[model samples]
Target: MAGNSDPLTPRAKIAVTAGKAVAAASRAAGRGSGSVIGGRVALKLDPDLLARLAQNLDVVLVSATNGKTTTTRLIAEALRAAGPVVSNALGANMPAGITSALAGGSEARYGVIEVDEKYLAGVARDTDPKCIALLNLSRDQLDRAAETRMLAENWREGLAGSKAVVVANADDPLVVWAASSSPNVVWVAAGQMWKDDAWSCPSCGGVMQRPGDDWFCGECGFRRPQPSWALSGDHVLDPHGSAWPIRLQLPGRANKANAASSAAVAAVFGVPPQVALERMYQVQAVAGRYDVVQFMDRDLRLLLAKNPAGWLETFSLIDPAPAPVILSVNARGADGTDTSWLWDVDYTRLTGHPIFVVGDRKLDLAVRLEVANQHFQVCENVDQAVQLCPPGRIEVIANYTAFQDLRRRVGN
Candidate 1:
């Protein structure tokens, strides 16, 4: 339990202790990391556990369909320049996971929380964040999550009349619409490569017209706002129009966009872009994404792509061919049951590479790849997948639950 040493009230303290104990027991018993269960039990014991723990902390809530976890990790790392910061580094974005993270970081002055998109409204209403970073929202987990427009509406409703400084992505119309309702918003031209989900305007249900980077609706007259921060060819332009060149250890343009968003949020908390970028550059990977591990004497690098938008971004990060690519997917509860999203991803881009498909849904991936006319072998697991390749480096791109399974198998 967090604050077990007298800061919280008797009820909260007891609840915290009980939750902590349960989590510890669960971990010891090999059930899972006790993060979520402990937090859930604690919340049940004391409904105000989160509010009480977060009362004095300067919380920053980050939410989006994609990049929220990575953005949250980057924000926490940048905020650490001020002091020690605590976050749910384990990828737990729900209330229970969030509460556990906050409780664990009870002494830290700043709390950076990654929130699940559907739960953003409820989490924001409870956390009372000092700053909110809204990354782009796209079609992800559609089988379980609300549709894009409704999710944006929920975000707008949550931010209504709130004073939190919102750092939003101007390139994403969904994000622009959601943060538009916030009183304090700092718009950044964070690039959105996948624009399929933003064709319809959330404001007036009209077709959104996109002329190059500019987007507007004919009916509502809503449009992309002038950005206070933006991404140039290879640099991030600050509010002063001063261009700051950013080089990150993380790969792909998506991370550069993420860095721009993180820097914008950090600026609201008194950390300058130059400083924030420096701290962010130190982060090589989030959770296990982009982590390279030795498997069967071959180096296997991991990448997580949960949806079509995410898969598109992951494709940008793949190592050049001769380096074999393995695609893994699962439709577990963590991953939405519908595997239709696989159809939306352009797997034909890997037409020349040695591709191996493996997962609980490997047959689905195999079927998708076959329809695209891409050749791949369906493997039972990573061990079998890597056995087909010569000893060197391999790339493994997986969806939600599949990524976790591989992480444990690879000892990440």
Candidate 2:
């Protein structure tokens, strides 16, 4: 009821109303927000409302710079094997947004909410999580966030005294170092993509050595042992619950890491390994994050690429599949204020001719595509872009705003 005049409400009624209107318009044009209610924009939380939500619940809080959406969704899916589980099905990661999800899940016994790094401390302060999963830290939204070091330091400080079982990714030196600070930690490591991004110890800036998936500083000897939960494989294990001797339908090497992280959580929750693995293959991508939509009788694999890291992994997914692609970019603030990160993405995986570029900022992406020495076609609008592609199978790499636009273009 605190829609219009609620001063303390973080989101104004006008903003929420406009968001709803936009969502409605997008759906009418084709794309759905999944929930028929559309932008169910729930932000401002009264003290009474907050207190009510915190009454009695065991919450699993998953926070990360990247991968939380897919990982959290995977955890929820795996947990479902045991009993009814509730989560922010729409990837609402902020406190107010999570509050909305909790309000919606009236009957859920287990609550899984993916928390954004900036809001993790505030949300955790209010509701102590039963288990906290911390994924890797990477450079993302530099405009909104400080360097990864600063953000990781804050996470280290904020989570100092929490009782929640800390589940962390150990492959990343920063994440591994953070877990070392906590006594009760469930570390997850991957020797799968064990390529060295870190040369020296994070603590002393000295050369580090990896002796059997265990990284330690040569000078300071700062080390975090191998994770209790480890995933060893040639390729990052795909979570799509695979049948005997076969992987699931989703594509991407990063998704294997995603599934591994979720599998660790399932282990913590006492879900059988076989059951967890089964659920992972069955788990699908959250809407807009590698979601495949059947549009105009053509299949469009929508990969939401918001950051450099996401784009990098998504590029790998597109490499093996010999499908024509539509690389969409948008300059809207919601998508990103600066599209300069396009430089950081490795587009070498993309090998083909006349890649279609769609977006309000089609010219910008067209310029980049051209520089890559690849065939390029610029579309004034998304509808025309999708029209150019043959029906049945096509790939779309979209940023946030472009995702909505892309959905509508494909007649979502």
Candidate 3:
């Protein structure tokens, strides 16, 4: 219910009131997420609703093909040291979702937003964020986001002439190219675990060569930008070569990279590096990415993997032992219909581990696993699948819709 107290035009005030009522009704009826529908209605009534809401707020936008939600949460949490901050904690990254969050937290002085990759340009132009964090880019929803290169090109053009300082991943060549036009940039060596998408230089279309931590293109003379911030093992290295140990509740190197990226963004706002790292350590889960839920007779740790890069990172977080893992995938609207990206994932990483396949596309996953010589069992239902595993903690990795469904069922 917190929002801007400033006087609004009669029409704009009416639109806000109507949107609030719709959001409340949607929450009451449980028909949908309510985040988008209300915003959709408000935008229809006032096309400039988002821009108005963003007028006086200091905004920090986080966008990437993957990890946008988690990274956004990290940055928002760190910004709490300054004062009250507004953010979309429900995994809403599109314009509608952003509109709802800005409207709800209108009075807050600072905003941390997770923006969809394809809509980054428009959102950046609308909000005029103080700092825009470019994490990494890769093929996400081929059905929706046709090409990563196109997204980078759009970002390059979108950020042009903006006064916002850019915080970009130096290890990601695509990110480097995308934020190249920004006048002010802070580069961080947040590790790029997935390189398949950036094998070719986006600038000159030449094959890129990686020697150690640096990458360069023979054809374009484009190379990895030197990072001002970087993560070394369990510590963060600053431009001055000082190291600070980072403690995080989230597992995996990717999450550490996310923390580094957030720390860099926080520094832009004058937040101490130690304070930012400490704040990030307190974040246990984002939406349901790494939440552990008890279902039936077992504890299920939920991990969301929508594409090959995501799967790769999630797989590394799993214990090397032969523990039972459940994988669910759906071709619903939220999850891209084309599941061919499954072929790109290295399923062999779980070669000896036990896997339980579930969801509408369980058969597809089963075939992929079989091709990799990995043993797996098909369970159409997640609740039923948990019963097959030993009575302990189990790992559940699912795509977009399937993950959300499991979170709903488990009351997470």
Candidate 4:
């Protein structure tokens, strides 16, 4: 039914019929179970179905190695403060999720879809977004993504010579180089607040030398400059991390970068900078990206770390002296097919190391932790681990699916 190549094939018709039936039934049941991606069950609507919603709805696609999901949600929230908006707010960034968001909407002036870097080519080619935002690219899921350079090249091809305005992270050399010559590119960075730099040099192949808060390439003299719009604080506070006063939330330097990136997009969309900043200050944490929750007796924070960069950032934020750390490592099919990135994480920074390690891959992580000369309690189950993580200032580092499994167990 979706303009089939073989109109006479009953199988094709049945597939289309199934999609329609699923969509219809989901609508009737007030559910979100019909979205499809990679032939797997999708939690978001399909893009083809979304095309039928509104005519000429502006679509914004955000893709990156990290921070895309949170940044997209923040951008969507900010835009919603201004007007009605539809986005794949559920962290599903592939084609199916994009499709689901589009399909579920009836009247949306704008569509903001977070996209997976690997799926960007297909999604952008099919969706033809009016604007595409490339957040910072970092090393992530090496087995699936190959390397950062590969992802950068993929996105470069994905844009496909489009006229869409591109928003890039100028702080990230990879992003800066990827979108260097784009006509309408807007460069943004985390400004002077961030204090760490790793990865390849944008100027030359040599390592980037960090002289201070900024990074400079000694080989080629290319340095990270102050962006057109930059945050001035080490932390972004709505009410200074409190849900009261002004709906304050969000933590970590990476999240501040996410907020800054969202603000940059708002600027490109013609929203007044001050207005955007005000809206940004109103942002709360998106799920799994440092989202804090209250358990029966203690506070549980869920921080998703799917790759080396994210894991490193998580470690950097923990103060190395936080109460205790609980790490859940599940290399199950859902979290990922590869857990090699665990080796790259700076586990040595944890003060006395994580107190508990749980998941199907608990032993693997335990062994890794042991090699780092860090001590850990290997628990057979996530619930058992959570029970062992007593209150105070506990931190959790969970991979994609493990985060949900742990949350479900911990009752957070």
Candidate 5:
């Protein structure tokens, strides 16, 4: 908890108390972190708990297919240059989990929220955030989370009705279309590696004209906005063309882009660019992503990639050729039940790596790899997988639940 400037109503206080108690109990029982269950109980007791907790706090909502969690964490740290900040969600991101996070940090000056794409509209309506960062929209968890277009439409309608300043990616058509309806949008030239989902224009259903990283719609004439802020190599360029270097402890170009977007959002909060970037550089990992842990006498660097878009980025993060890379997956509800997304990834890009497959759905992944002619061994878990690989550092990339399973086992 941060402060006591705004007091909760009696009913809301009771809800918060009960929710924290339940969360603590759940943690003790090892059922999970209790973020979801505790917030669920709190909401059951007081339906207005979320709204009540959000009051008096400047909130920043971050939604994207791949980097929402990392972006949210980065935004929180960047805002800390202004004051005490509490992030809304990490692993838990729905209404319930968000409520729990708000309750836990009742008096923080800011709430940097990692919102699930499907729930962004409702969550945004509830929080009435000061700013919203609309990262790229792609086909993720399609079986349950709806298609990317539907989520875009939802965001379009929601942003059209809100007063929040939108910081959006200019490279993603779906995201651009969604944020276009907003009154105040700060477009940023954040790179988007996965272009599979943005082939058609959302405005007129015209075939999108994408030449290299540039894009346009021939029918409706909608195109990427002239970004006021853009990224040049490892530096972030402001509206005035002043470039600020971004130094992050996190790995990959994807993370550097995340830092750029976070700094843009923090600028709306009155934090200076250098201050924001410096604070963001302090963040080593988000949740368990990009975490390196010692396991079974081998260093396991954990990475998470659930969809084709995320996989494209993950492929670039691993060590160069012949490094042992373990790919794990699961069909649990947390991960969309269908394993069909496995076929969407260009597994041939990993041709030279010594790959291994694990998790409940390893066989499905093995079959996918077989078609691509990528050689890999099947192991029961990280322990067995690491035992077979040469001693030193090994990379592990897993889907949602499989990542969580290994993260929990490794004591993250």
Candidate 6:
């Protein structure tokens, strides 16, 4: 619980108490996550509560289409060396969640927050953060979100007047376009594995050319920006030609990229690169991501993939050999009502592997996999799906709602 302090006014103090009470009641009831509802009540009582609490704090805001939660966790871990750090680790990324975090961690001197992509502009403006990290951009939650380019434009417009230093991914063209307007910017070549969304140049509407990992526009002069921090394989190269090894317990190149991005943001706050990287490696799991859970008869490693880009990166991280895998999906409010993005994933890559499709949308995934001629079986439940596997270790990957369900069931 956050302590009530002198920084909060009389009205703000009342709102905080009310919000915390609601959170406690909701948690006691077990209806749903209390973070969102508690924050809503707080904001309703005091609309300017977030801005007031954020004053005089060293804040870092992280936004992206994917990996924002993990990246924010890494940044928060690195900032722990300085002092107490307050962050929203529950995956509540909107204004309500951001406000709740600020209100709860009133005594902390530093804040590391994960802001949703659509709300990045408004939150950054209100918080007046010291640094902002832009990971990448892709099509996600098409039912609710605007087009990728539109979001990028909004980000460009939102950060135009911000004095905060922007740490952006140079490999992602959309991220480059969004953060280009900021006067204080640091570019990092954090490796963009998914390029389907960035086929066209946002500036000129021209076809972008990708010639062996480098992107350039034929019509416009837009090209991949030179990076101040570059991640080559397992090593992060600094501008002065020095390389630092990033050894993280989390697997995959995507996590390596995340570590590099965190190191860049930490540098802006006077955290040494070695210290930042060391702290980043301490994170073994985040919000059930990359966690191995012991079920009735199997050990399942959880992975969350919400979009085509996320699936691509997650697929690459899996072992090449065929094994038992459980893919759970749901189209609930949090998972997006439209499951059309399933078609965009290259299911053919798992041709020889044994796959178990489980979730409300298992039929949809089965149809897509059938069209791809991939072998798979649909199970009634997660436990049932895992029961089909031979034994030992099984990999479980899920979207938003299904991941949460599994996380709660497994007690992660």
lDDT of each: 0.89, 0.68, 0.88, 0.65, 0.89, 0.89
Residue 15, candidate 5: Cα error in Å is 0.8
TM-score of 4: 0.80
Off by over 4 Å in 2: 1-45, 191-201, 205-215, 234-247, 319-322, 390-392
lDDT of 3 by residue, 91-200 (tens): 88899889888888855888899998888999988888999999999887779885888889999999987799999999999999989999999999888888999889
Instruction: Show pairs that collide, candidate 6.
Output: none
- For model 3, the local distance difference test gives 0.88
lDDT of 1: 0.89
Model 2 alpha-carbon miss at residue 271, Å: 1.5
Q: How many pairs of residues in model 6 come into backbone collision?
A: 0
What would the TM-scores of all predictions be?
0.97, 0.81, 0.97, 0.80, 0.97, 0.97
lDDT score at residue 64, model 6, on the 0-100 scale: 99
Predict model 5's lDDT versus the native.
Answer: 0.89
Please list the residue runs of candidate 4 whose C-alpha ends up more than 4 Å from where it truly belongs after superposition: 1-33, 37-55, 191-226, 234-248, 294-296, 319-322, 391-393
Model with the higher lDDT, candidate 2 or 4? 2
lDDT (tens digit, per residue) of candidate 2 on 74-170: 8888888876777877776766557655654545566788888877777777766778888877766767776776777777778887887888887
RMSD of each: 2.2, 6.4, 2.0, 6.2, 1.8, 2.2
Q: How well is each residue in 60-177 modelled by candidate 4, as lDDT tens digits?
A: 7888877788788878876765667888787867665565566555456678889888887777666666777887776655556657766766666666477778877766776766
Model 5 collision count: 0
Candidate 3 similarity to native, TM-score: 0.97
